[model samples]
Every structure is written in C-alpha cells, then in structure tokens.
Target: MSAPPSGPSLPKPESITASLLLGAMFNWALWGVLGCQTYLYHIYFPNDKAAFKYLIYGVFLFETAQTALNTHDTYIWFSRGFGDFLNFTKVLTSPLNTPMMGAVIALVVQLFYAHRIWTLRKSWLWFCMLLVGITLAQTGGAFYGGIRAFQAGSFVKAQTDPSNRRAVYVWLIGEAVADVLIAAAMVYLMILRRGQSHRFRSHGILARVVTITVESNCATASLAILSLIMFAGIPDTNYFTCPTIVIGKVYANTLLVSFNNRIVLRNLSQIGSPSFSSGSNIVTSSRLPLQKSTPSSAGRAFESDTITYTVHRFTETDSTTEKMDHELQETSAMKGSPSHHV
Candidate 1:
C-alpha cells in the first residue's frame, strides 16, 4: 500500500481547458446572434425611444467587449502559452468576461423587467422593489466573486478558498431566484391575470405570451442552476464556466428576442383586421388593444403608461366603447405590443 502524492494536484490538460475553450466558443456564437438582433432592432424599431435604443446598443457593446476580452485570453492560453501548464493556471481576463460583465448585463435586464412589472400593476410596487433588491444583490455578489478570483491568481486557489466559493454561490443562486420570480411575475401580470377576460382566453393570444415569457426566463434560470451544480460538484475543473460564461449571452438574446417578437405580434394583430394602413408604430407597453371597434377612417392609438406607440389605423365606433364593461376597459390586452416584462 502506498500513499498518493500530496502536493498540489493538477487536472489533466484536456479536462482543464476543454470546458473553457468550448465555453468561449459558445460565448462568441451567442455574441454573433446578439449582434444580428441588435442590428434588426435598430432597423425594425427606428422610432423606439432613445433610452430604449441606448439600452439595447449598450448591452450589445458590453457583449462585444466580453467577446473581445475572452478571445484575447484564449489566444494567450492556447497560442502564446502553448504547452505551459503554468500559463493555463492563471485567471487572466476570464473574471472580466464571466462574472463581471455578465453580472452587469443581467442586472440591467432584470431591472428593466422589474420596471415593466411596476408599470403593469402599480399595486405590485413592493414586488418590483424586491426584484430590484435581488438583482442588485446578485450583481454585487458576482463582482465580489470576480474580484476574489482575480486576487487568487489561479483557478486552484479560487476553488479552494471558502469565501470565494460562497460568493459564487450567492451570485448564481440569486440569479436563478431572480429569474424565476421575474418570469412568474410577468406570467401572472401579463397572461394569467387576463385569463378571466373571455376575449383574451378565447383568442388564445394570452397562451402565446405565457409560452414566450416562461421559455425565455426558464432558459436563463436553468443555466444559472446548472452552473451552480457544476461548480459545486466538480470544484477542481472549469466545467461551470461553460454555462456561466454564456449566461450573459442568454440574457441579452432573450431581451432582444422579446423586442423583435413585437414584429410577429404586430402581424398577429393584423390577422383578423386587414384595414390597418401600411405604416406601423411599435409601442412599448403592457396593454394590447383587443376591444372591438366600428368602421371609421381614423386609426386607433394604443397608449400605455411607459411609452407611447402610434399603432396602426383601425375603424372606431361608439357602440364598441359603450358596450365595453368597465373591467374590460381597465384591463387591457397584451397583443401587438412590446413585451410586458421581457
């Protein structure tokens, strides 16, 4: 019988870098998708508010920066450092790309959704505030973890330290919790709450909204949970980075897709009504116009609390408004509108 060597143990080269390399490749792939979405958003919603435009472009730029930094670090590890185990051990720029930038992007997206929740239901102000707190806490944890990892100087040290690991736990767990809450809030506010309305349920439009909200948020939350599992289960390897690095991309793409989906929604709205003129106004709001109207030349404008959108022209009649129930008037639809809380 012999005791195993007790000195610092290193993983096989294949295991050590394979996950990281694959993660970086996925990160770039998602970045490409984000770029295309950003361009499409610019073209499709030219009249979108300046603040909205700035947010979309800002996230794109942050993702671009992350991809660039990841590429530089990858080159250092595989090109310049080729065959050198020491080079592979260093933290390099990974902290910047993975937790640092990723956390900031997630925070922005979460807060954006939170604002939407507030806009939809003023009474849910407390819920929105709670979401903001969770998002901010996760971002703080991520930044703290990134700093700790960088200070550790090496993956081995970062994993071995309890404080560093705790920080990571906070970041990932908080992210998952925030994502789930956001999804649930959107579903409840935008879809389920409207279930009582006969028109919405009958048309099945609310069903589609529910699907989109759940699927998008589920994707991000699942990844965060998976990353947490990998980090906890296999502490010695970089397996967790595979999912962690792409989390930001997932968040960015989800937001962009929600924005772009408005095009589809616009088409959906026009399905039954063909009288809408050529020009379209993409309005960001919680209410979608579903109330029936009569024949008139002038178009109808769907207004919301947050952003004003000059929607397509449709006929109007007095009976449509007079016949409407007070509840229906108060509770608007979510069709052909910007995501309620994407």
Candidate 2:
C-alpha cells in the first residue's frame, strides 16, 4: 500500500504491490455479494428455462472459482512468503490469471444482453455478431496474457516487459470496445423499435426498457473503460486493479437485476387493470373492469394514460414478439376486453 517503492531490493513496482493485495480483497467481497444475488434469482424465478438458468449459474461458478484462485494466491504471498515483497514464486503470481476469468464472466453477460437485443431486433444480428467476435477475441487475448504471466516468476517483471503489453492491450481494449458497442447497440435498437409502431412510440414501456438496458450496461461499460485506461495508461503501476477486480460483479449483478425486475414490471401493468398469465405467456389489458365512473369533482382523477408493459420472456426458447403479441390479443379477446399493443 506504500507509494512506488524505490530500492535495490525492490522486486515489485509499488503499484503492483498495492494492487495485488487490494485486488484479492475486492474480488472476494464482490464474489460474496454476487452469490447472494444469484441465490435470490434462483429462488424467486424458479420457472426460468434451463438456458437462462445455465447461463447465470455458469457465470456464478466461474466467478467463484476465480475468486478462490485469487484468495489462494493472496494467501501464498502473505503467509508462505512472510510478507517478502521480493517473493517471485508462481504461487505468489498466480492471481494474475483472475483477470482472464473476469474477462470470461464479462463476455457471458455481454452475450446475454446481446441475445436480448437479438430477440427484440432481429435485424441487428450482424451487430450482435460483431459483439460476440470482440468478446471472444478479448477472452483469447486475456488467456494469452495470463498464460505468459503464469510463466513469468514475478509480477512487476512481467508488467515491465514490452511483449507482455500486447496481450494486455488486446484484452483490455477489446473488452472496452465490446462494452461500448453492446450498450450503444442495445439502446439504439430499442429506440429503432420505438419507431417501428406509432402506438409503441408513446408507450412508456419502451422508454422503461431502454432505461433499464442503459443503466445495466452503463455501470459495466464505465468500469471496463476505467480499468482499460488505468491498465494501459499507468503502465507498471497496478492502479487499475481496483476496477478490474469488481467489473465481473458488475456484469453478474446486471443480469440479476434485469431478471428480478420482470416481476415488478408485471405488477405495475396491473395496478388498476387485470392481466392473465398462461404458461410463459403474459397478457395485460389497460381496460378497467365494469364499475361506476367517479365524478371529477369527487377528488378523483381519470387519466387517459396508456401503459404498455412488455415481458420479453427471453427466458423461454419459444417466446417471441409475434407470439406475445398474438397471445395479448387472444387473451384480451377471450375476456371481451380491448387489447393494448406493446
């Protein structure tokens, strides 16, 4: 935690020395929080399909394993090495691999969001493909960099090498690029869809969807960019480790929040109305049931606002926009109520 150490025996840069300790601690903390979020997601959304389940659980497991590795490395450095900053054994340096694992977790989240975008806007398949490619390339570079770091005996030594810089650059830059593209694509595609139907244009549901998408990806993208800038601009100083350690949790939590918010949206759509749920299909009508109208002077307000709530049900493999639309109409017709299109 000391400033850049300067001495004949200083085997590590001051930046890396502080980063190693801080990164391990931060990763463990975030991993614990992510575990709780994952448990809640499973408990609350038990009916989610296997694909959604596997995608989330897979990322959780990966993050857990990587955190364990980081903890083990931290232990080896502090306990086995007796706080010797000069210790350069592989055990002491193994935690460098955690960034690669972080990259994997991030890529998984990106793909999940990209899939959501694909479902809503099938025309953006090419853009989603580009995101997938960038993520894969980033993971590859992260693995390559990690393996080389594994081979090197010391952390600061590897950080100082020119050959090591390329892999680091590729991984960080690729991730930063992917983060920006995914966020931009999600927001843009949602806005594009808003223009598709004049009915949907005035609906707050599209705006809500866009807001959620932006909020989720904004945190992750900001962290990615900060980490990339520090890792690339600051050189040997491991100052970037702070953001790098927590970026994975941001990705994990993004998915968790997205999943849990579905129930809230469903409830909101039915405050003064009735809705029906058949299997994975949900149909909500904005029409009120038979009741006497309240007088305007009776301290009652009658707003003609229409709220459109869309539950994409990307959790189900067979769910689609067309199917949901058809079911909405069918359900409304069954109840003899007017249908509201989302």
Candidate 3:
C-alpha cells in the first residue's frame, strides 16, 4: 500500500477539529428546535397571511439546507478524512452553510424586525433606515469574508491575511450591533412607549411579548459578540466557529418564535374575555359607552335610557390581525370612539 500522505505538524489541530465538531453538533441540535417551532406555527396559524407564511417556510427551508450541508462538512472532516492531520489546515469545504448562510438568515431576521419597528411608528423612518443600512453592511462583510476564506483555501492563510481578518471583524461587530439595536428598539416601542399609554400599561400580553423579544435578540447578540472576542483573542484555533455555527439557527428560531407567539396572545385574550371563542368566523368584542342620565322631574325619564355597547368584529381573514400589537392598537382605537346609533 502507498504510504499515507503526511505534512508538517498542524498547530492546535485537535483544538480546531474539536471546535468544528462541537459547532456541528450544536448546529444540529438547534436545527431540531427550529423544526419543532416551525411545525407548531403551521398547526396554529394556518390562516396567517400568505406572505407571512411564505417567509416562515422560506427561512425554515433555508435552515434545513444549511443543516444538511453542515452534516456533510462534518462527515468529510471526521469520517472521510480520518487520521489526515493536514485536513485541519485546509479550507476543505465551501462555507456555504456556516458564515454565508448564517449571514443571510441574520439579515432576514434583522430586516423583519426593522419592518416591525416601522409598522409600530411611521415617524421612525430614520431609525429604520439606519438599522437596514447596518444589516446590509453586516451581510456584505460576511460574504466578503467567506470569499476571502475560499480564495485563501487554508485556515492559516485566512487568519494571517489582514483583509480576511478585517472582513470578519466587520461582520461580527456589525452583527452584534444590529442585533442589539433591533432588541432595544423593540423593547422601547412595544413595551416602554406603548406601556406609557394607560390602555396598555398593565396589559398581560405585552409583558409576554417583551420577554420573548428580549430573550431571542439577547441570545443572538451574545453569541455574535462572544464569537468576535474568541476569534480575535484566539487567532491560533477555530474556537469561534462553535458559536458562529449556531448563530443562524438562533435567527431562524427567533423568527419562528415571533410567529408562534400569536397562539399565546390569542389564548390570553380568550381567558380575559369570557365571550371570546376559538375558531370563530367572526370574533367580537363589545365596548360599553359611558352614559350619564339626569333624573327627570316626572318619575325618572331615565326609564327610556338604555345601556348601549358597540361590537367590533375582527374576522380571521383580516391580515392586520396577524400582528398582536397592531391588533391591540386597532382594538384600543375602536374602544375609544363614541357609539352613535341612527
């Protein structure tokens, strides 16, 4: 048999391989979570808007493809290239599933949140523009870094190249910044500003939404920042790949969680209103108008006065009802109006 191929001793070979292995494992685990969330959303919100449903399924399918590619990359490294020390140094595979795919998913999620912010307040056009700009830059940096890595064809070259390293720095920093901004804007607009209004100050559904928003965005931002620190601090190994690999899944999960949360809000509303029924074609909420009747000199002419309540009907087909905050705002506006009868 021909002698096995050999090369110079690889620096931190075990560290690099271990990081890749762990990243692959974590990626698979997060994929499972994404699958479950997507399934739950499908079952719960069949009536969701076509565009909304397409976005949900699109991210999910993209994530699925990435997961498959991750598995193939892992297999190539461990199973096929077993005992090949030199494989650790090489680019080995196109990073289509890792940094590239992750960047796309992050961009999609960040932009979705940006749109949400716009829907909340049209006057915040400047804020939304800034967010979109950062998101695009982050994605551009990630793509450039991936291109540089592919051109280098080896981890050593990629790490040593100033341009490659700079691209990665830009990508990671931008990702973290974008995530933090999205989270902060959401909390401020949805909870702080909305809650300032007496109508939503003590709303239970709003509290739950705030909690989910904070948890999801914080998770992604923390991972991005951690990856940046590790990549910068430990230039000799691939430790950063661990968190970087799972970052895409976190974005996908964030989107799914946002979609699935309508179930929770719907349940909360049902509990708060006894008349609320599930799967009803026409959902109705009645608001009682404030009325003051003076006692008549003739034995209370108020006998003719009758209590009046106006019913606001929301149909399942209404696209505006897909967003909880929007629905709540509409309900509040209707409740505040005076009821006039002909």
Candidate 4:
C-alpha cells in the first residue's frame, strides 16, 4: 500500500526569513516617508495648534526603531546558529516585552483619535465614534489574542492547537472589520464636507489651511482602510511566517507615509503666496469730495462732487458694484501714480 499522504507542509524556513527581511525594509521605508512628511508640514504651515503633527512624528520614530529591531531579529533567524536564533525569537516575542509595548502605543493613538471625533458637535460625532469603536475593537481583539497565545507558548508551539488557530482568526476578523469601518467613515466625511465649500467665507492662508486639514485626514483614513483590507487576507500561519507578513506590513506603512507627504507639500505651496488679509482690497464709503486746487487768477469756479475710494481693510462688503468700482479705481490710481513713487 502507498504510504499515507503527507499532511500540509509547515511554512518553509526560507519563506520565514524572506518575510522578515521584507517587513524590516517596509517599516524603514515607511518611517522615512513619515519623517519627510513631518518636516515638510512643519516647514510649510508652522501651526502651533497642530499638536498631532508631533504625535505623527513620534509614531515615525517608533516605527523606525521597531524596524531596526525586527531587522536584527530577522538576521538572527536566517543567518545565525539555530539555537541563538530561537533564543532571540523568544526574547523578542515574549509576552511582557517591547512588541507588546508597541501594540499598546497603537491602541492609545486610536483612542486619542476617537476622543477628537467625540468633541465634534454634529453628525461627525456619531461617525467618528463608529469608526473609532470599530478600529479599537479590531485592534484590541488582535492584541489580546496575540498576548494570550504568547502567554500559552502557542506563538511558537510545536503542535498547532485549534485554540491557537482560532485566536489568529479572531485577530484577522477584527482587523478587517476595523478597516471597513474606517474606510466607510472617511468616504462619507469627504462627501459631506464637499457640500460645505460654498460656506467658506475666508480666503488665502486660512482657507488653504482648512482645506489641507480636511483633505489630509480624508486621504489618510482612506489609505489606512485600504492597507487594512490588504492585510485581511494574510494567512494566520504567515503572521510570524516572515516574508508574507512583512510584505503586507510594508505596503501598509508606505501608503500612510505617502499620504502624509502629499498633505505637507500641498500645505507648503499655499504658505508661499500673498495672504488674503494683506492683498485683498477693502470697501469704504465716504461723503467727502475730492480736494481741488485754487486757480492762480482767483476767477475759477469749481463744483463739489462726492467721490468714493475703496480702502484696504480687514472687512469688505460682498456687493458686486462695490467690488467693481474698487477694482477700477485701484487700477486707475496705479496707472496715474509715478512708477518711482509707487
């Protein structure tokens, strides 16, 4: 009789090594992008109120450190002696360790975002809560399950138990749900805000800043959702299987970094232009007549007529006639003034 069919092969060692390398590369590149974006945003907008920008920068730093650690671990796993490598994995994946710390940080950031959304007085509050809740649920589930598995020694357990597999399933499902919710909320918010363009009264710097904030958040949320979805299909075995997990992680990080960079660039471009408050004309009406010169012979007569000239001030009316008159007068004055004096 033919020998019994062999069971499905465990993931190959080579695959694991490749995955780890890729993951490390991905994280490094992602952080690099984040750093660049942060630099650009700060240089361009220089907004003291944007405390979250620093938080984002901190995230990039943490990711960079994590990437370095992961790279070391991957090297140990693939190139160092087997005993030494196994020891390294144990230390790195220990229940009470840096990986766990990183996971906690991630959760904290999500909660912070939720709090911000809760402060909004309109439908945004509900929308933000839903997105935040879904994200937290997924992230929390994965984190808790992973910790449990690590505690039970199932993370590296030789005999794959159904319980261990189930834990992974829960984590995956949670991540997927979170991704979908975040994506849906982002798209909805974008649509809602698009309708409010007509309500924007301010122009120049203020308007540009507001536009950037809205666009960046929407883009970041959308990218995050897309990355999460891409991660949903990753096999449970590949969680620590190396190359596959690494690839997915890299892609997600890159997307986030790219979105941030785009926002920063757009914001910077707006900052270089003449600000609306400084450049726009103000409309003011006066009953005073123009000053006329007296004739040398003292026989010339002149009639007094009301003349209106627009002044540059902080406030101006929205009347079309007033705006047209202001522009025409300004143009005429410019042409009549001596070029050297002006």
Q: Point to the candidate with the largest lDDT.
A: 1
Off by over 4 Å in 4: 1-11, 82-91, 94-121, 124-127, 152-163, 199-342
RMSD of each: 10.1, 9.3, 9.4, 12.8
lDDT of 3 by residue, 117-211 (tens): 78767899999999999989988988999998999988778889899889888888998998888778767765555645454323555666666
lDDT agreement with native, every candidate: 0.77, 0.65, 0.75, 0.43
Winning candidate number (TM-score): 1
Sort all candidates by lDDT, best to worst: 1, 3, 2, 4
Cα lDDT tens digits, model 1, 1-342, are 999879966678876788779988999899999999999898878767778888899999989989999899889988999989878788898888999899998998888778867776789999989999999889988999999999999988988989889989989999999999988887776545554655532244455555676788899999999999999998678889889889999999988987786655543433333233343332223445454444344345434444334444344454532333222223335432333211
Candidate 2 TM-score to native: 0.72
**How many backbone overlaps does candidate 2 show?**
0
TM-scores, all models, native as reference: 0.78, 0.72, 0.77, 0.53
In model 1, where is the ten-residue run with the lowest total lDDT? 323-332
Q: Model 1, which residues run further than 4 Å from truth?
A: 1-9, 190-192, 200-205, 274-342
Q: How many clashes in each structure?
A: 2, 0, 0, 2
lDDT of 2 by residue, 1-342 (tens): 789967764325455567768777777787888888888777766766777788779878877777777777777766787666566234343535456777878788778777776766678789889889988888888788777776765656667766666887788788778877767875676566555534422234455556776787777777777877887787656677677776777778777777655544443333333545556655554554444444445234333345333332324344453454454443221111222223
